[model samples]
Target: MNKQHGSHEDKAERYELKQTLSTLQLWGIAVGLVISGEYFGWSYGWAAAGTLGFVITSLFVAAMYTTFIFSFTELTTSIPHAGGPFAYARRAFGPTGGYIAGAATLVEFVFAPPAIALAIGAYLNVQFPSLDPKHAALGAYLLFMGLNIIGVAIAATFELVVTVIAIFELMVFMGVVAPGFSIANFTKGGWSGQDVFSLGAIPGIFAAIPFAIWFFLAIEGVAMAAEEAKDPKRSIPIAYVTGILTLLVLAIGVMVFAGGSGDWTTLANINDPLPKAMKFIVGDNSGWLHMLVWLGLFGLIASFHGIILGYSRQIFALARSGYLPHYFAKVHPRFKTPHRAILAGGVIGIAAIFSDEMIKIGGQTLTANIVTMAVFGAILMYIVSMLALFKLRRAEPGMERSFQAPFYPYFPAFALFGALVCMGTMIYFNPLIAAIFAGVLMLGYVYFRLTRSQRETPPQNEVFEPSEELA
Candidate 1:
């Protein structure tokens, strides 16, 4: 009796995550997780493909994400687990597929924070010239992780507040830059640095795939918070559909306004593109420039803080499934957060920030390299997730689906095709980063194989069950 009671207590402590997120909070998390992309990373696409060329790439990627979220929503509402793609793949393809999906997600969530943190640092540097961006980045990791560890409700409330401000600041940026916007400036040398578009621009378009993807890269991370959502079936769909629409408008608006304001090439290859673009229109000493520098940190903060939430849930989910050390699965007794997993992800992010100068690949900055690596993970997970969607359709047709993906086969199929194309193009353009991504997966698989016998059986919550509505 004592043994059984102890086991019950352990299970309770290990699996609890407070279901406190509302639709607005979920929307906040959905948008917050990817909004930073608009502030910084996507400009690098202009470096690779020029303004018009990158515009084409962004539109294509935007289409891919639109379709992907529609299809992915069905799975989230059906499963409603913190694992997101990891849980879906596990249900459809069992342990190995789960490992692949989980590992890919870990890569995506883990690596993305460092890049955003560095951007936050860069934004801070614009205000405080003497501060080291790396040090600032490290401080960001520490501060946000503590916030996340405090509790889900607190973390999500903060996300909502900051995301709203970030969105408003972006609108402010567009309004302030509108007077200087010139079509001639936007189109000049806009096709892979050529004045006109041609078939010759194809290579640059392919090379720009990852940076273009940055715009909506982590929006799907909303799925990670589904388990913690109140009435996930109703809230997930609303948050996801609305969130994608919001991001698409902001991405196009921000990109066009910035490109048209000045020589687009100057905005490329920098972390603080919005402020720099504003400086062209407002000058170096303007209040508008200072406002952007200060408020801009909110965009980076939203993503950095939200992703820290995302990575911890993924780490906790993976560990609970016996794919990682059980220590990571522990929920804090008081806070109800995955404290260990949060800290673990933080350590990796800090290490990447420290290695910014030490590690070089393809002559890209640390931000660029990590962004590419995260994109590789995201594309792989997307492919596997769409496959899981198809598999579950056949395998469990009767499962309760609160939200069915519109267009069914067509929507998922298009998403799959786009993911495949992006993955192939990314590999062609970034062979070294692709190899490093592969190496991480291979090492993870080896560990799985070696520990197969000792692995614990997954708890009941890790498995899917039809909703009571179906019964």
Candidate 2:
């Protein structure tokens, strides 16, 4: 009897994640998961809609993310599950909704890192012209996956350090370029490359939605780490509220500074825009330009490393819930990290990095298409999450909520509306990627439906039960 009981305890331990993240660490994960947007990907918006037009798209996106974060915090605190949106949707709408949410979140987290990793390689290439960007990107995946597997606390600490440095670097970038910034330069040909806005620019603005969303795309991934937070209910709200505000300021500051520094056209399609923008201001040989090249890497690293952490948790949670193969659910015995999940995500990201040269769609680079696909996943998850929030409010009225979304129905309603608009525009502009995204989700659903009987219930300790009020 004693030996049987010990085996059962060991089985339960295999699925548990350690709780060690504090408020500051949680804030770091929130910002770190997205800081790379200010560095590279958002510049593509300039190519799609020009400066002023993209700005309009950005503001709309910022509004959606702000409202979404405010509303999302309530669910994070109430459920506090590693599955994040998946857990909430499962409780509110059952297995199908949970599968959709989990699959979408997985796509968002998994696809995001490769884009950031490529940007990291681009930054390194600026310094070492002989090195292949793809090789550097692959190396990054290996390095960070090791760090994450070592332990969550160690990973979170590293994320916090890099995130702070990245933020400071952006402030430095704005200050260095301030003297060269010109409002006339920024607004020149600011509407779909035309000098003035016209009815024609409407399509460009809509097309810019994905790049605009890139500016704040993965900020919501913080919810994945809620299960590992030391004080999730109180700490998550503070971290999320403050983190969104921080990214908003950084995104705008970085964009304005880069656009106004030189010919905005030159920065539009490149992965190393900040360094190139700095070159225009300081000249290529200046130490300041060199410094930007080296330090700009941290912004990309912060996001790449942070998103790897996010994707692994999502995979682990899905596996734990039997939505994915149980092979991925095992936590490392000593480190208590999801080793298989981290390695699994890294393999996917590395494959993407390798395929960069072989793939191009709609004349956009692999990085751009990857960014758009990630946004598709993110927007879909956002729409489903908001719907779950509404359903849960009615279905479990007395469910304990340490933090309530301010303005309730209005805030979430607007978030839902904005997400739907973004989704519609993205599909209109990027039909091929949209189709691919849909296909991935459908395949996942089929697997989920066929395997319903084989699904394993998580251990009792891993399950989240509502308070007595829910009874």
* Per-structure clash totals for the candidates: 0, 0
lDDT of candidate 1 at residue 424, scale 0 to 100: 98
Which digits, one per residue and each the tens of the lDDT, describe model 1 over residues 19-137?
99999999999999999999999999999998989998998999999999999999999999989999999888877888899999999999999999999999999999999999999
Q: In model 2, how large is the Cα lDDT of residue 247?
A: 97
Q: In lDDT terms, how accurate is model 1?
A: 0.92
TM-scores of the models, in the given order?
Answer: 0.97, 0.97
Q: What is the C-alpha lDDT of each candidate?
A: 0.92, 0.90
Task: Provide the lowest-lDDT 10-residue window in model 2.
Answer: 462-471
lDDT (10s digit) by residue, model 2, range 42-134: 999999899999999999999999999999999999999888998888888777888889999999999999999999999999999999998
Per-candidate RMSD, Å: 3.0, 2.4
Off by over 4 Å in 1: 1-7, 195-198, 458-471
